[model samples]
Structure formats: C-alpha cells, structure tokens
Target chain A: MAQKVVEEAVVAVTEPAVLIHRIALLFSPGRHWLLLILASLPAFSLFATVLPEDRADVMYHRYDGGGVEVDGPSILVRKSVMDTVSLSANYYVDSISSASVDVVSTASPYTEERTETSLSMDYLHNKTLMSLALTKSDESDYLSETGSFSISHDMFGDLTTVSLGYSVGNDDISRNGDADFGDQVKRQNYRLSLSQILTKNTILGVGWETITDEGFLNNPYRSYRYLDPLAGNGYSYLPEVYPRTRTSNALALRLKYYLPYRAALSSEYRYFNDTWGVDANNFELAYTHPFKEKWIFDIRYRYYTQDGADFYSDLFTRRAPQTYLARDKELSSFQSHTLGLAMSYEIKPGFLQFVDRGTLNLAYDYIHFDYDDFRDLTRGGVVGEEPFYSFSANVIKAYVSIWY
Target chain B: MLTNHRLLPLVLLLALTGCAIEPWVQPYERARLADPIMSFERDPVANGFRHHVYQTREAARGAEGGGGGGCGCN
Candidate 1:
C-alpha cells in the first residue's frame, strides 16, 4: 500500500473543509463575507436567473375648453414578476367634443367616446407594502366598475410610512338618446397615509380621504333654471335635482425639500368637505431640476377654491319647485388656476439594447376658471348685468418610456 | 369656517409634535431620502394623468387618493 493511499487523500480533503465550516456558520455579519466569496468560485453557478423589469408607456392628451374638445391616448404596462412582485396595465381614451356653454345653450353638438381599463398588483414584504386594483369604464351611455385595496407599513426604521385604503364603485347610466333612461350609481372610498423622514433633506406627508355617494347623482344631459315670471326676463329649463346621499372629506399636506443644487422643492395642501354644501381649498407648488446627468426639469403651481351647493343657483329667483336643485357649474362658486411645465430626457443604454432605461416626456398645462357664483345661462338674465362665467384651458402631454 | 375647525386640532398637534423630535437617521443617511424626488409618486403614469384631469375639472376631489366611478364628464 502506498502508505494507504496517502491516508485516503487526506480524508478526502478534510471532508470538504468540514462542510465549508458548517456553511460558514450559517451566514450573518454581512452575510459571512458574501458566503466566503461565493464558496470560492470555480465554475461558479449557484443558480440565478431573475429577469423581470419591463415597462412601456405611451400617452398623449389634449383638452381645450369653451366649446370643448378632448383628445386622448394612453397606454401603460409594467412588470416585475417577483423579487417582491409588481404588475400593471392600463389603457385609456377619451375623444370627446362638445360645444359647451351648456353644450351651446342646452343640447346638441356632440361626439363621444370613452374607454378605460386598468389592472394592478404590487407586493413587497419586510416592512410591508401591498396593492390591488381593477377598473373598467366605457361610454355610449356610461358604465363603470372599480375595486381597490392598499396597505403599507414601515415605521421607525424606514423613518415612518403608513397607509391604508379601500375603494369600490359601480355605475351605469344611460340616456345617450334616451334608451329607456336607465340609472344607477354607488361609490365609496377611504384612505389614509402618512410619511416622515424629515431631515436628510426633508420629506413629510399626510393625507386622509373619505367619500360615499349613492344612487342617481344627476346629469341626464343637465339643465336647470326656473323663474319663468312670464318668460321675458328669461329662465325656464328644468331637469336637475340631486341628493340621494353624498358625503365627502379630504385633507392633505405634503412637503419635500432637497437642494444643494441637485434641486427639488415641493408642497401641497388641501382641505375639502362636502355634505352637499361644498368647501374646498387646494394649493400646490413645485420645482425640480436636474441636468447633465440626463436632463429633467419641472415647474408647477396650482390653486383652487370652492364653496357652493346648498341647492346651487345662479338664477331662480323663485317660481316654486326647490327641494334640491342645481344649475351645475360644478355646483357654483369657484376659482381655479393651474400652470405647469415639464420636461424629461434620459436615454442611453447602448441604444435600447433590451433597454435598461429610456424616457422622453413633455407636459404643459394652463388653466383658469373663475366664477364667483355661476351665471351666464347663455347670458339671458341680465337684470343688473349677469354674465359671470369664465373659462380657459389647454393641456398637452406626450410620453414615452421604456425599461427592461 | 369655525376657525378652520379649530385650527385642525392644532395642526394635528403640531404635526405629531414634529414627529416626536426627528433626529435619528442612519441607514447610510438615506441617500437624499432615497431620491426619486423623494417620491410621493414621482410619475405614476404622470400622476394618473393628473388625477384624471383633476377629476374631470374639479368640484373638489379627494386631494390625491384613488377611487374612480361616477362621471357624466365630471
């Protein structure tokens, strides 16, 4: 025997180095030196084939007011099946066209098309996160459906985060040329959110929401006005009465900051209430900048105000009939303003070789609307000079995105 | 408005006492709070198409929350 084959080859290499030191004492301390350099790689391959991270986007929008016009196109898709899951899908379309001012003084001048679809899913664990969604919409006499759920958690280590949500909706309405006039409606929503991490460049957020509605909430081709005291001071159209039930609440606050030239600043505030006598306020401000490391820019501003809807009216100085009536200029008293701009660019990954990133975006907005007390029933009740209805609008967007 | 509902509970108790006096950040100092504009949704399909165009031109909506249904173009 050659010394008993050299002691059986040193007992087969010390029994695989004592089973890799008992699997590197079951990893800890930053994963035990990356599992001892992946067990000393030699023809390495411990199995890893995780491919997921795909995206696609497309959008186009345009809207103009006063003699309305809407335009559309939207599409989205996302994926990340695992590594904590993710998924999404969407499609939207609008294509409306009107002749506003109450559709050019009460009816006719239409073109419609509406569609929507959505689906979503998300999940993560280790401090939690969750979501689920569904939606559907259709036009030619309306239809809708919705469902949603949400959850989030992470506290005192993720510097706080909290969320909760719920949703439900169902609707079906008809009268696009009166197909036996159908109706139905229902809605519900609830939400809450919080976020912290306030310093290391700040961040803070808060939100609360609630909503509920039930049954036929008006709009069968709207119309309302009454006081036909012999028709010359003009005013006599009917078909508006609402309040089967409604409830609403909202609150929000947000802030973000970070600047050392990297740029960022944001803000938000909101408050709202509704039990039919509205009260609202909203404000927003934003700024963002980035350049050279792949361009980005943004600007924003918004402001809004509201109050009105305790049987809203702009004319209707009596002639009976009033147990809830509205001449819906979104239920009267209002104020609005918006201004926005955006830009984005980032694309470089060997020209889309399975694209690991890509983006190109553009945005614009400009809106204004003011009406202290909705008037202008096509300007016909000029007692002491009526006419207070205003409008202005423009919005445009373009998008492209890719990631894989 | 009732003194803004009594100053909204004293601004939510001074924003939860300024989140209990902040100061405790260490996860490698959260790299700019893990930027993405410190996301409160930095583009989720352009914030869901600007929240559906301000919920079809506002009449007051749930200041950024999700839910949809009921529309007669509003």
Candidate 2:
C-alpha cells in the first residue's frame, strides 16, 4: 500500500509539470497566462476530497538597509476545486535601488527589478496529499526556473504526519552590459520532515534538507579587494571567484505549545553546514496572542550566526591568492538578530455576500547584522585594519486576505 | 535502493505500531490545536517574503519547508 501510494504521488506530480509546460509553450512572452489559468479554474472543482480553504491575498512589502531600498507588491490566489484538488498562483515583484557599501566602492549604484510567478497544485488521496509547484523568476541579469514535488501522509489516527519533497532548479546568469558574458547554474534539493502531536496542547516538528548546486555561483559584477600599496586606496579590486559546485545540509526542529490563557508559543532551531565550510545556527522564538475574537498579535525574535566559507576573505595579500576567492559579505562570518511584530484584524463575517471572511494584517521587523571578518571600507582608516562591518535594516509588510 | 534500505525500518516501525496506536488527544480536546494561533505558518505570503530576504542575506538556506528557485544573487 505504501509503495502504491508513492507511485500514485509520482504520477500526480508529472501531470502538473506537463500541463505547465504546455501552458508555457502556448503563451506569448508578454501575455498573461496567469489570468487564463484563473479563468479556467472553476471547471476543475468536481472532486469530493477535502481541500484547503479558498483565499486571495494582496501584499505590499518594503525593506531598507545599508543604502539599499527594496519594495514591491505580491499577490496570491488559492482556490479549491470540488474537495480533492487545490490550486494556487502567485505573482511577486521586487524593485531594488542600491548604493550599498560594496557597490559604492567598486561599482556604480544601480536600480533593478525582479519579477516572479509561481503555480502550484495539491491533490488529495485519502490521507495522502501530493503537491507540485512550478516557479519562474526573471530579472535583468538572471533567470531561474524551478519545479518541486512533495508527498505528505497522515497516520496514527492523524496524530503524526510525514512529508518527503524534492526540487530541481535551473538558472541562467548574464552580465548587464556584457552580452557575451553568460553562465548557468543547476540546483537540486531533497527534503524530509515529520510532525507529531505530543499532547492536546503541544506539537513538534523536525525537518532535514540537502541541496546540491553546480556551475557558476558568483556575482559577475562583484569584486574582491587585495592589498596594492601603490594603488590609490592601498588596495585594488579584482573580480571574485567561487567554487563551481557546492552541497549543503540543514536540519531544523520546531515546537509549538498552547498556553492556558488562549495564547500560543513557538520556538525553532536550525543547524546548517555546507561543502564550502560554512556553518550556521539559527534560533527563533515567537508568541501569538488573540484578543477577544477579532484581533491577533504576534511577536518574534530570531538570531542567526554563521562562519565564513573556507575560500572567503575580507582582504587577500595578493591577486588570485587562493584557488577559489570570495569576499562576499554573505560568505563571511556574521551574526544577525531580528525582532518582529505583527497584528491581524479579522473583518466581520459576511462583509460581502460572496466572501465568507476577510483579514487585514501588518508586520514589521528590525534586523541588526554584524560581520566579524568583513570590514567597512567606507570607514577608511586602513584597508584590512578598518572596523568590522555592521548595519541595521527595517522591513515592513502589509496585506489583506479575503476568503471566498 | 539506498533510500529503500533507509526507509525499511521506518516502514516496519509504522506497520508494527499502526494497529496498537490510539490517539491520546480526543477529537473534542483538539479545539485548541485547531486554532489559527497554533498554525506553524500563520501567513504564507508574509512568511514567503521573509524567507526570501533571509536566503539572500545569509549563507544558510532551506529546511523551513518552503522551496523556490534562487535569483543567483547570493
């Protein structure tokens, strides 16, 4: 029976991939295929299996930090057909304006826009739920396509759930002005997770994932600096280089408990390591409180720390000093802390004749990042002797959801 | 084949315990668990954005159950 279920899930996964492929081929570059899919959705709601609630969301998000500003709008729509199938589509965009430290010292500040679209479907078979998703992201210099499939099973009277997932992605990278500079990357991910209800008020979850990446993995425009006593700033910049392949593994544990006063508390921990010799740990704690019947408030704190990759260096002694060289801040030893707050207000039921419920939500987060090895070049005392880099960021999100 | 070997023990364990297992929390006692507050991911859209931000800013990625392609910015 288990084998049969797996086989069925695999079959279910392929169906959506084929459909999405055909849809992609049919639509022109500028045509709105998402609208076409939405128009044709009602025809599929003929099954009698349990499905997720139908809802639509519109969100606006903004992030500001380190002389960089990113803001955009995202929209998501999910609808169920009959009882057995659910489909979701999302459109997201990011408009970025950057004068960040790295860009300022080595390159000119610039503005860019990224757009992403995704389609997903879930098929329910008894206690098994199979999910398939396809996503495409496009920007001026990068294009990525990804597909994922997962199977989830509930057992032991629904007290335990297990999921297995896999995803494959392909990316094409290009330089903004250099038409001849082009590269590609391929990635694969495998994931496993288990959730168990320990008691009436407590639940536990564990997840493990592995990812492998191959091909070009570094930014074409970014450069690493090395000491050059005769140069203007005592250092000269050279194009950064990175390993051609990498593999990483991450394991996470999460727990949530209901408090006696109608509130919930949750915590999560994750450990991650990669073949590039980066090790990271993340911890988060959150509390959720509901006021009366219409309002919910949440507060969370997250801390993350990571060691530098083996090939990373804030400053090298000479040009091409290492077989693989990286000066990316994200690859350096660093720690970040985030504090987040969110509130949701439920709209009165039947606010509209066609809608069952609605909600308005706003969330804000403050993050502080400190780097141990990477220096702030803008400070400019000495090249490698400068102060460690640190910066703070603010993120805001506002969204409205309507359930039909 | 290697995956099958790894799953054999789990399959056996589940099969052995399937018959004897009884839900400790009765259906009537599950109201609290069903509350929206108990949801691991209360806001999917917001969570997705937050994860994207972290993935680009940090070297660590994955294991939070969300999967999408990368922009290669990292």
lDDT of 1 by residue, A305-330 (tens): 88888888866776546788888787
> Could you tell me which residue pairs clash in candidate 1?
none
What is the number of backbone collisions in each predicted candidate, taken in the order shown? 0, 3
For each prediction in turn, the share of the native Cα contacts (below 8 Å between chains A and B) that it retains comes to 0.28, 0.50
Instruction: Give the Å shift of residue A83 in candidate 1.
Output: 26
Worst 10 residues of 2 chain A by lDDT: A41-50
lDDT minimum window of 10 residues, candidate 1 chain A: A43-52
Name the lDDT of candidate 2. 0.82
Over the true interface, candidate 2 deviates by an RMSD, in Å, of 11.9
**Tens-place lDDT digits, model 2, residues A202-251:** 98989998999999999898899899989988889899999999999999
Q: What is the TM-score of each candidate against the true structure?
A: 0.31, 0.86
DockQ of each: 0.11, 0.32
DockQ of 2: 0.32
Residue B51 Cα positional deviation in candidate 1, in Å, after optimal superposition: 1.1
